[model samples]
Target: MIILRTPRLTAHLAVAALFGSSLLLASCADADTTSNTSSVSSSASDSPTSPVSDSSAEGTGAGNGGTDSGASMLPSGSSSSADEAGQGVGGNASETEEAPKTSDEAVSEAVNRVNRDYPNKFGGWVFKGDTNFDSAADLTYAKVEQAQQGNAQYETLLIFFHKGEYLGIDSTYPQQVVSTAPSSRGLEVVYKDWEALRDSGDANAAAGKYTSTVTYYWDGAQVQHEGRIPNTGL
Candidate 1:
């Protein structure tokens, strides 16, 4: 019982040393393998799939981002429906038609037509001469220049025809006289041809012997005429 077992103790110590060394080597190998594996994974992630590539990562990124594709596509049918509703089928129809003539143009055309139809039928009647009781006196067709100045505002033509010739003619005397008069006169020249008396009266008025003038007018036409009484003061 008191004797020492040195060989047995030595064998036990050697077995423990071997076991510790194996454990350290195994741990170191495990660490190295883990680091190498991590590096290899990072390298694989960085490498491009196509080796001689003109292709870019930016293009791939844009495809993945999804915004570019949406922008390139055409609008839907519902958008077209909205545009059609806003425009309506009748739009611009009125603009395609011709505009009508103006009022001024129409009026000018009417005046032209009247002038063409009634071209100065009473031209070359003597306008000025002394009054005579006989039928041979110079009768004139003068315009009414001023109603108060013994002048006519319309184409009031003077005539020397016998009173009977004008009076008996239908649509001649009364019509012409009334149409010519600016205002009705009392005790108007009844029997004699009234033109002589009226003309004399107008001459007297122009000489300042009277306060008013007498004139004549033509009743039926678009055009007008006027006559000026000669001044006796000149």
Candidate 2:
């Protein structure tokens, strides 16, 4: 603390001195208050409100999960695996859709299927019938001489016809026809003309009984042998 003093001791002088001291003390108090106010103002100006914000960190993807920009959110390799699986599915779908049914495949299925509507006709040459055979040859038969049986001679003329892919045999039975040629057993079926046989069967059924010499014609072939197999593997 600082104090201001005077040497005079008179009443008048003391009064004057006290007043002067009072003014000096007031001036000093005012100066001290002004200094404190200036200091506070300076401190306030130098340390103005500086509210630091973390907004930049939030904008850099830190608020979400601190992930890098434009980075994938899925687990490692998940995207690639999903794409491969999708492509595989698409390939399978395309194979199933683009595949076509072929005639050979259909024929294979048809070959195994039972044809209930086969041979619409009873006595005729049918292709791929119940009993169908294929071969390439011209079959013939020679007249048997002096072959007599049951008051009838086995002497007849045979005609051969080339009906495109099949051979037609024609014969006439003008007399009584025997069920089995007793003299002609163990014959060889070297060739087959099924077309003529089929026609002959129907023709015999139509002609009840041959009372006199008659003629029979077959639109197929004659039996040259019995059970004569050739090149079975072929």
Candidate 3:
């Protein structure tokens, strides 16, 4: 259609056309941005968070139940023999070697060793620490007494040892009392022979005083009789 074209209308029409072209370009750019965003979201949702093989996932699920299992799937304290062996390896001296035994432990071990090796050899003897009547000696000496049932008289034996090795025994005669003391070089044992007083006419003479006194000393190798003193009167 042939229409009148005014200068002002022509300039207005040109400005409108330019504005329309600008809006169309902006709308196309927005649509392209939305499509790209939607495509990226779809790709993210389809892909797995972590890359893992199907076989690996199945094996893990079979043993550990799922991908996010608890501490049960982790290694325990005694998990493997290799782990236990590793604990004692290297410079783990505390785990490899045992702790040093205490004095009480050594005494108990010595007593048990003697009892187990020589069962009933000491005549049903009772250990020193086991009874109030008996006296306790140092670790180097163990004093044991023959079990005194109803009688007041029993034999006592002094066992000598050097660092857990059994040396020898010094025993008192029946109806005699024996005592021990630590000497400068070794140990001293004194025996009171009251059996000689049994023949005395006095009823309480035997229990009142001993008839003789004998001293013995341990000179490392063996126990030697030092000397003897006799009591003439009770």
Top candidate by lDDT: 3
Best by TM-score: 3
Quote the RMSD, in angstroms, for model 1.
39.6
Best of the two (2, 3) by TM-score? 3
Model 2, 11-112: lDDT tens digits are 669898999999999999999999999999998777534232222111111011212221111111101101111223224312122233243332223232
Q: Kindly provide the TM-score of model 2 when superposed on the true structure, using C-alpha atoms.
A: 0.17
Q: What is the TM-score of each candidate against the true structure?
A: 0.19, 0.17, 0.39
Candidate 3 Cα misplacement greater than 4 A, ranges: 1-106, 109-123, 130-139, 172-178, 199-205, 211-214, 218-220, 228-234
Question: What are the clashing pairs of model 3?
Answer: none
TM-score of 3: 0.39
Better of 2 and 3 by lDDT: 3
Q: Model 2, residue 56: displacement in angstroms?
A: 25
